[model samples]
Target: MTAPQRPRVPRRALDGVLLLDKPLGLSSNDALVRVKRLYLAKKAGHTGTLDPLATGLLPLCFGEATKFSQDLLEADKTYEATMRLGIRTTTGDAEGEPLDVRAVDCDEAAVRASLQRFIGEIVQIPPMYSALKRDGKPLYEYARAGQTVEREGRQVTIRALELIACALPDVTFRVTCSKGTYVRTLAEDIGEALGCGAHLVALRRTGVGALTLDHSVTLEALSEATQFERDSWLQPVDALLSTFPQVCLSDDDMRRFLHGQRLKLSSLTIAAEAVNAARVRVYSAQGRLLGVAKPGEGVLAPERLVVTTES
Candidate 1:
């Protein structure tokens, strides 16, 4: 017999998501770059941005996984925040210089009741010191130049806002809300509600979509662990996207799908309303993930096929 040949390793061995329990003092991008280095990932990006002072769940997408991040980014988020009342900062948090201060008396009941007023839908103007853009320049640039511009108020839904503790001017609260809701601005608004100005002192993201801090790993631990340990923390790319329906096809159907051919619906069942002419998860009959498909009317078309035969 001829000498046996060793198989070649794939160019990119890693793919999927990483739920990082980001430490305080690292910007979201900074954490992403470091994690990318740890995995030697060729392509990586975070689903959401976290401020330097905040810490908690930051989902990093690697390889083909980055394509699914948009949906995750839009998912509802939960946060635990501690705000210092009686003072407001220019950057809306502790990073900025103290802009205003006022002494005030506050009670726990009063604080809890005040938080109730902010529940439900409300309009919030983007802060000047934010990354919002105007004339192709970040609003923070204008803020640094002492220039203020008209900012349209955005409707943000707060699912729940509760005061966990109120010790004089320092108050801690938990908020579950839709995407785009700014916790820092909420803190300032809460301070205004309490007849005093306030700024965020400490804030941590507890959950994003279905991923939570409980399932996340710290950067330090991940850095020191073996590849097997690190890979265990990856949530399936589809785990956070269960709301979307899934469609599985047979081998023949998958062949057609790989050729970018559209087929009439038959045995597969997906939410009729969910099956628009858009991309969706595709799998084989054995429940192996193949890729995504675009379905229209009663026809299906493959978008990205992740099928593997040798595996």
Candidate 2:
């Protein structure tokens, strides 16, 4: 006979965002699982994927916060990366075997000039060993099978690419770029520009949207904290929508919004300029975040609203 099974603990309906300092070698999903289990959260998601080779700030969304998580995914990202010159890897990073090696001959001034060339808009051909999918399968799967597929060059803006340090074969730099910018491919391009092929050796994400590494907690710390203490680390749901304009409504109007009704733009007390925005965060008079709304010519139509027990 099978032994009696233990009772399962009910997951909590938690809401908020957690800035995780993801450790090297841990995939973002694995880290999210740990945070979810630690908080006993019923719903959870991450703003973006941090590769196993990277280590740094990874924002996690719980419950209501998940509603606005997509906003962060489209925001700018910042990272400090180190690339080893004179060596090119198949995957464009240290994780891959060296495909080519040469002597490093570029100076710091030359590195600075090369960085300037990528300061604005640039095009990149994503590597084979990436999460991009084709025919319902990730390109990485095709790469593992030693197959190459055609990938078009995508236009990605490199808002800023500043050199941090240069020590012969290894070069460190900080980059701020728009969403979908592949830094590994960037390092390879820069290396080729310098006449010395390179591969990424280290990467640490420091910022996403308005969130930064300054207010992040490591997994090790969360493991040692009490459940209540861990809950305190979560930012309010509105944190994910910081860049969006906010519209506060009365209890009665909030009820109407909950029922998928629209309000006249003239009825709102916000500044004239804000009413014209594409999206706005809707909040109840009692300071509760209701959800989001899109402004029409004269009406504020509900876009994505919070899920409530009553509705």
Candidate 3:
């Protein structure tokens, strides 16, 4: 006899962000799916990606929070990584196939000096095994097909780099950098500068914008928790825009702004410093986060608007 099917859980609309401590071996999307299914979330997205070889803070957004997820992409990031000297890889990480190996001739002094050369503004050629698109296809696809593509060098800023430990063949370091900075490329570049090639062996992102790993919860922890426990872990949607200047609009203005109308800057109480900002967070007088706006010609024009929850 055929067995009866169990009732399926209905996906619910959930709003807020989850600071997930994404475990290694799962791509950012893989981790997001697991967490979304756990919550039965109707919609969800990640602020940024963490490779399967990386493990650390990956903020997942659900419902309204997803609207502001793009903001974090431009936020500075901090990572702690370990690179093996005298070795180069196809993917620039431990997961890649080793291309070559040599002797580790450089000491900590040499490593430190090499790292200094990468500090501040520097250019990097995006790796072929990256997600960068060429002709509507990811570069990784081309790489898997054994095809090489010429990529433009991008300028990225390295805010700081601190060597944590130097254990001869293995070097551990912490780096704070601007958006679009690739730690793997930095490791490879430093390796080349030291007269020996290197590739990332271990990597953990500790910070993104204002969020830190300390505030993140692991998938294992979430699995054991009840629905209420999971709900409690969700950060307010506005948390994603903490770095942006905020303006609380009046009830009339809130309605107009929500309806896609622009507001006069003279009528809104805006900080002088924020007037020239590229984007500003807009909120309702009742403390509800409205959305984001772009300042122009003494007016605040709606950019990305949040859909208000139904009554």
Candidate 4:
């Protein structure tokens, strides 16, 4: 019999930040490239990496939004993970071959107690299948060639690790942790404490900083939606940097600031008190975003000018 032809994926400009409800089985970068083509964006990047076995809120930044990736990356992340007990893998997830298996005798109370070990500030050694670099190459590359190397445990905070469900060999938990935490490592450690080996079977990121899965759209939906429809999903660039102080300029001040001139505030009419030359969000008199600015001695000096009066 003749082999059937595989269907080709269509291409389309993916701009702005896309809260991708990424499906399982695709790598984070894979999803980013796919979304990039959809928006025809000149540049694109992802806030964080999600394993192929994981699914959930993967924020894809396009165009000038890529510059804010560092802020998004530093934000805390939340995940809903399923840990399968009685077996351990080299990779720490289901993608690897089983290396060992232990008899499980874990109960709900026991599982909860075991998880407590991971809570608060702790150090964890990342798995071999991780993207952590060693001598300009990913550790997973060495792992594939049957090479094991020394990996130092780095400090990562586990703000909350609660057992959502426990059924002997299978345990589900919600972990709200700091950046760079590996749930797979936590799963293995939990299994070891319970006298059983375990590995992560499923994982889904529920939130990243302020962005949540609730505000995300799936790739399937994006593929069917038009450019105009897709553009509606973009939250303003300022939305990502809400932590900065805001400054509302008068009409004349806005004009002066846009024309490469500084606004001298001798009396300090800003809404924020105690402003001493810090980066602030600049907006027009009509409440339109102008961009970020740095305040000097009685003057508003723009450091990173984005939009101007013409814009």
- Global lDDT of each candidate: 0.84, 0.92, 0.92, 0.82
RMSD of each predicted structure = 5.9, 1.3, 1.8, 5.0
Point out where model 4 deviates above 4 Å. 1-15, 243-245, 251-267, 270-280, 292-311
Ranking by lDDT: 2, 3, 1, 4
TM-score of each: 0.87, 0.97, 0.94, 0.84
Q: For model 2, give the 10-residue run with minimal summed lDDT.
A: 265-274
By lDDT, the better pick of 1 and 2 is: 2
List clash counts for every candidate, in order. Answer: 1, 0, 0, 4
Regions more than 4 Å wrong, model 1 = 1-11, 270-280, 293-296, 300-311
List model 4 lDDT by residue over 88-201, tens digit each: 987898888899988887678888888888889999998888899999999999999999989999999999999888876889999999998989998898888888889999
RMSD of 4: 5.0
Provide the lowest-lDDT 10-residue window in model 3: 302-311
Candidate 3 per-residue lDDT, tens place, 22-121, comes to 9989999999999999999999999889989999999999998888887899899999999999999999988789999988899999999888888999
As a TM-score, model 1 comes out at 0.87
Which candidate achieves the best lDDT against the true structure?
Answer: 2
lDDT, candidate 1, 45-134, per-residue tens:
999899899999899988767877887789999999999999999988999999988987777887888899999999999899889999
